[model samples]
Target: MVSAVITAAGLNRRMREDLLSKGMTIEHKLIMDLKGKPVIIRTIENVLESGVKNCVVVLGHYSEEINSVLKDFPDERVKIIYNHDLDCELSETLLNGVKNIEYGLCLCVAADQPTVTYNTMAKLIENAINYENPENIVSILARKETGFLESAEGLGMPFVCHSKLLLNYLPEHKDNLNPILREMISNDVVFYGTPAINELELVNINRYNDYLYIKNKF
Candidate 1:
């Protein structure tokens, strides 16, 4: 069995401030509309349409609002878990979802990335299964993602790995995955794959402009 883990616990501080300054009143970025549909729904649709059976969504920092959005999706494979402390870091969100999963392999992704497609996710899962080591994480490499150093190795999420591989390195607090990724790099266990996906799907949206660009393109 394989489960898809989605982390959407971010405060969306940048996105919120950007919208407020522009005279908009959006609070929950994950539930914010992405080309008519909510962002979180669009992201999960990608996973479900990709032929993944099980999905686990970790919610925090305004769980009620996100829950309302999730109710629209009637998939039995979709399950929700809550983080009582909104301050829990992103890594914990990843851990929260995977720890409850009984699957040997899981696909991890960020809910904020709406353009991430099912094709990319499916390819990553295949890569993980064929990896030389079960512990090695199969991650996708993006060429056009912004808001980070261009030199950064992999895009933030959409990684495939065994549950045990992550538990061994997961810390209690990690807003970013760099530390864990660095640890894997030092041990030479990270496998990067360039799947045949549209570069737009890998674009990471943190601000209003990003949303507009994605909206206009797709």
Candidate 2:
């Protein structure tokens, strides 16, 4: 069965500071009423609706606050894993989630990306399962041309290997996987990338302005 690993451990430092200066707290950001429901709650709901039977959420910085927001959700389907080292980088969070998963393939998504639709996720899973090489590391979305035009160009791929590929590389390059993964692709490691139905679903909320933009749009 397919599973999903969501990384939500970041400090949300910028957004937290922005709210605090306005006489608010991090809890406001966690359970903030956006489009009538909490932001992360909506994120989790979307994942559940996406057909994934099991989901593991890796929590850090605001673990307590995030958990409080999701307390009403059923424990059977969604499991919350805490990353005690809140100061660690995103790579650690990704690794923590992978270690707990027994599924052959797992989708790693950023928790702050609440706009991801069930359709987009289904497409990713479909491609991964039906593609010529199901074992190849498959990314759900690709960076759009508009994103490049807007000067947001980088390695536009999403997704990474959960087993053979990532596990083999981590021992030598334990710090970051991006460069190593890229090099592996160059050296002919099986990799797959699919276009997203809506590019906005890939937008990750990092700063206060980003949160505001998403709120205004959706």
Candidate 3:
């Protein structure tokens, strides 16, 4: 059985600022509308449809809002963890999720990536499960510059890795884990890259402009 973790624990400072200007103190970007449903809801729904046996969502910045939105998912299939340190970097959020993963291969995906399809997730899980070398890390590569996609932007360096390897290497550099992960890839860490499904899948909403762009696209 493959496990998946969705990291939703960032301050989303820019989004919060945008909301504050409109007289809102609590605006959860993850729960913001995308198309018709909430962005994070769409993300979690895709994970459930992808055949993953277990799913863990790590919440931080807007925990109450996010948790309230996800209250309908069954506790048995979806679990939530709160990260009090919202200021901590991505590495810390990843580490928190890794500690809860119970499967051999855990996929750490970002909740902001609402465009990620179930088929894309299935492909990643299949590669991780069937890969001959346990040390190999399976990842996805984006093709174009999607406005909201973070990994596909120039020099953004998008890729995914096995939870075991990520957990092992993340602690060495608490501030940033990508550099260390890339180093591992250079040292013969078998990596399987999939063609970008669409530039939209890589979009990560970081600012008000990004949110507007995605809203307009939808």
Report residue 200 deviation for candidate 2 (angstroms).
2.3
The numbered model that scores best in lDDT is 1
Please give the ranking of all candidate structures by TM-score, highest first, separated by commas: 1, 3, 2
Name model 3 segments beyond 4 Å from true.
19-26, 143-160
Worst 10 residues of 3 by lDDT: 146-155
How accurate locally, in lDDT, is each candidate?
0.76, 0.66, 0.71
Poorest lDDT segment (10 consecutive residues) of candidate 1: 143-152
Candidate 2 ranges with C-alpha deviation above 4 Å: 20-30, 145-162, 170-177
Considering TM-score, which of the candidate structures 1 and 2 is the better prediction for this target? 1
Pick the TM-score winner: 1
Given candidate 3, what's the lDDT at residue 205?
79
TM-score of each: 0.89, 0.82, 0.83
Over the full model, what C-alpha lDDT does candidate 3 score relative to the true structure? 0.71
